[model samples]
Each structure stands twice: as structure tokens, then as C-alpha cells.
Target: MVRRRFPVLLLHIFSMFAGTAGNTQEILYPFGPEHRDLETPKMDDGSSAEITLSISFVYFNIPYRTVYVNNNGVISFNVQVSQFTPEAFPLSDSRSFIAPLWADVHNGIRGDVYYRESTEPELLEKATQDVRKYFKNMPAFTATWVFITTWHQVTFYGGSQTTPVRFKCILLLNLA
Candidate 1:
């Protein structure tokens, strides 16, 4: 018997991101050559090693200085997320999971996943502006730390390698 694969529809990936203890807003940050500083190794349902952030960020009153980004589109704090499918919100577990678009991503077959933490003045300034625009109530908001991850031209677990999706997730911290 011949097999046919159907496209898996996912929630608007860009609108999904995890943040510190507060209201989370969607910010469109540039994911260009300047931001692609590091890359996740090629693998199926794999994740980057626990990456330490430049600044400590708190979630649920807990501060985490380290995090990891998985090929399946999960930026986790406190632990590595091996789960490929996205679980319903208000997760059953206590681990901080940021599901950008958790999928059975097989990057080993095709594509590149990049992540980096930034404190560069220029980048920070841009992030600050973006946040301020969204949080008009906090007109003086300035983003001092940011974690950016992008799945550039990444293919699905069994989809055609030629067709891919490009998306990014950005987490910002403004302790001031």
C-alpha cells in the first residue's frame, strides 16, 4: 500500500512564547545574520544543551539562569524537554516550557535551528522599542536581556525537505 502524508496544522507559532512573571506580548524581533550566533546540532527530536542566559530570569517566582532550545520548538527553563508534541497549556508538570511550535522536527534530515542570548546595545535598543510599543502603559520599558531562537527553513518529521517553515521566538527581560 502507498502512503500519503497530510500536513499538520499548528497554532500560529509566532504568537506563542514564554516570558517572565508578567503579561506576555508578541514582539517581532529581527532574526538575521547578526542574531544567528549559535546553532542547535542536527538531530531528530533533539535539543540544545542547557544554555546559560546572560541575565537571570524569573518564572513562577523562580529564577533561572540556564535554558535550552529544542529542535521541536521548545525553549525550556530548568530542564530539557524531550517531548515532541505540544501539550495543552497550563502544563501538568512544573518545568517551564515555552512551546513555540513543538513538533516531531527532524532537523537532522534538513534545516538549521539557531539560538543566542543578546545584550548588545543595538539589539537591546530595538527590543526595548518593540516592548514599549506593545506595553504602552510602560512607556519607559527597556529590554536589557533577550533570548532569541529561530527555526530557519526547518522541515517536519516526514514532510518534504524542500518545503519548510521559518519562525522565531524571543524572550525579553526588563529588570529596570
Candidate 2:
């Protein structure tokens, strides 16, 4: 298959390719006290202290047990990324990250970032249902690990007041 931008966002359960199945909107997962919150201003160009994953998450078939959740909507496996602007795909650099919506963002002035790793029964069930609904071939998939990073009500960095953005990346690792 062609190398495409990561597909299948859990938001409203839609693939990156819209119009293929009339997927136009993104419906994010509901956040509550369950997720760990990231501090602001401090997290403007910063990232969360490294988190040891409850279970290793394999990306590109490489197993990783640690990660840094950056304020700019990315879950990084290498060093935390503070670059506001996003590089094109097939990058020349070696930064490893899963960007749900990487951009010049700052939670310092306004907004919040939250993250968590869970295997909660309810969450797992929801994740499994979502994956099956979007990726039809994975009808029997059941998530054993779930990682979520959310940037909510965040403003732009080095700019005047801008529209607040709310987005999230939910990674479901089916270790079954």
C-alpha cells in the first residue's frame, strides 16, 4: 500500500480519506478526570516528563516502552518536539512522533493538554468498537492497550489571539 498520512482517527471514527465513505467530521473521545493533565505555559514549548508505557507499544514494528507527550499535539517516542511548524512526511530527520495535529501551539497562555495510558474495560470496549467500525477488516480486533493525548482550548504561539483548537490522538494497541 502507498505510504499515506496516518489514517483512522477515533474521532467520530473516520478515516483520513473523506468522500470515500462520506467521512467529513471528527468526533473526539470524551475526556474526564481519568486523564492526567499537563501543566500550561510551562508546557507551551515543553513536553510531559517521560512516561513508561504500561505495555510496550510497537511503532513501525519497533517496541517502545517510553514516550513523551508534547504540548503541540504529538506523542513522541524520541526526544520531545518543540518545533511549532510541521515538517512534510517522509521526513529527512529522525524525530519519531505520532502527531494528531502538530502545529505552532501554546498552552502557556491558554488551553490544556491531557494524556493517559489505560486498559479500562469501558475504554477498551469503545476502542475496539471504533476500530472495527472504521477498519472493517479488523472486525475481531480487541484493544489491550490505549494511550490518549489531548490538546484542548489551545491557542497559537507567537501570534495574536487565535481560534482555540481541541484535538486528540488515541492509540489502540491490540496485543491479542
Candidate 3:
């Protein structure tokens, strides 16, 4: 019954030291969020107009997918109609002449869709065709018509993984 607790205490300390020596320490490098600084482009100081239309189609290849699509885009139509008319009216004239004028078409990317593997190209083709058809039926105009189509590829955290998607934007402008 003599003091025998000294040996037990020493053994506990030695075991803890041995355990720590064999374990490996890991070093972690944490990253902060990324920032993008962009400047706004100079826009024309004129009135803005917009026209929206709905497109519907049935794809036999992908019957289960959506059949109705809403195609929309921005319209920039800035032209002087009074100058081309027989009588040039003053700017103060409240009664403006309405005639077919020039139109500048600009297409913008709207939304993103993630599709299954090997289906992106087919889906994109189908969507593009449908958009073209919708615009072809628009009323004829006199000025140059620009059609802008935007496609975006977004990656999270700048990683290699990407979601396959297609977006079609159509802008139709008619002046009377």
C-alpha cells in the first residue's frame, strides 16, 4: 500500500507524447470570394420600345421537355422619319409622321439551363431553329435589322465543371 501512484501517472504522460508524435498535421489554405469590377457602356439618349411574342413547338426527340417557349429581346429603333418624308416638319410639330424606319437588333442572353450529357448540341440546334422561324414572320422594315444572339457559359468558383445550356433571344421591330 506504499505510494504506487507515481508509476501510473508517468505512464499516462508517456503514452500521450507517443500518440502525438506518430500523428501527421494537416495544413489548409482557405480562399476568399472573387470580385469582378466592370464599367457600364454608353447608351443612346433616346426613347426605348419593346415587343414580346410567344413561340410554341413540339420536339419529337424530346417529347417530355417543354413545348412552349417565350422568346424576348431588346429593340433599338432610332431613325428620323420626318427627314425622309416629302415635307420636313419642325421638332415642335406634335403630329409626328409614322412610317417604316431603320431598326437595330440586339440579342442578349437571358437564362441558363443544365442539360444531360450529350444532349446540349441537339437542344441548342432545336432552340436556334425555332427562334429563327419566329423572327422570319415579322413585318418587313426599311432600315438595317441586326439580330444579336447571346450564349453564356457559367462556371461556379471558376472550376472546370460546367452546365450545358442554350438560350435564344429574338427581337422584332416594325415601324408604321
Best by lDDT: 1
* Global lDDT of each candidate: 0.70, 0.69, 0.21
List runs of model 2 lying over 4 Å from the truth.
1-27, 32-41, 159-162
Over the stretch 107-132, how does candidate 2's per-residue lDDT look in tens digits?
Answer: 87777777777788987888888898
Q: What TM-score would each prediction reach against the true structure? A: 0.78, 0.79, 0.19
- Candidate 1 lDDT over 1-176, as tens digits, reads 65221111112243122223132223335564665668888988888988987666666566778988889888898888878877788888787867877788778877788888778898778777766666678686667677778786687888666656666777777765
Give the 10-residue window scoring lowest on summed lDDT in candidate 3: 5-14
Better of 2 and 3 by TM-score: 2
Model 3: residues >4 Å from true position, as ranges?
1-144, 155-160
TM-score for predicted model 1 compared with the true structure: 0.78
Q: List the residue pairs that clash in candidate 3.
A: 107-148
Q: What global local distance difference test value does model 3 have?
A: 0.21
Candidate 2 residue 150 C-alpha distance from true site, Å: 0.9
Tell me the tens digit of each residue's lDDT in model 3 across 8-50.
Answer: 0000111112333332211101111211211111122112222
Ranking by TM-score: 2, 1, 3
Name the weakest run of 10 consecutive residues (lDDT summed) in model 2: 12-21
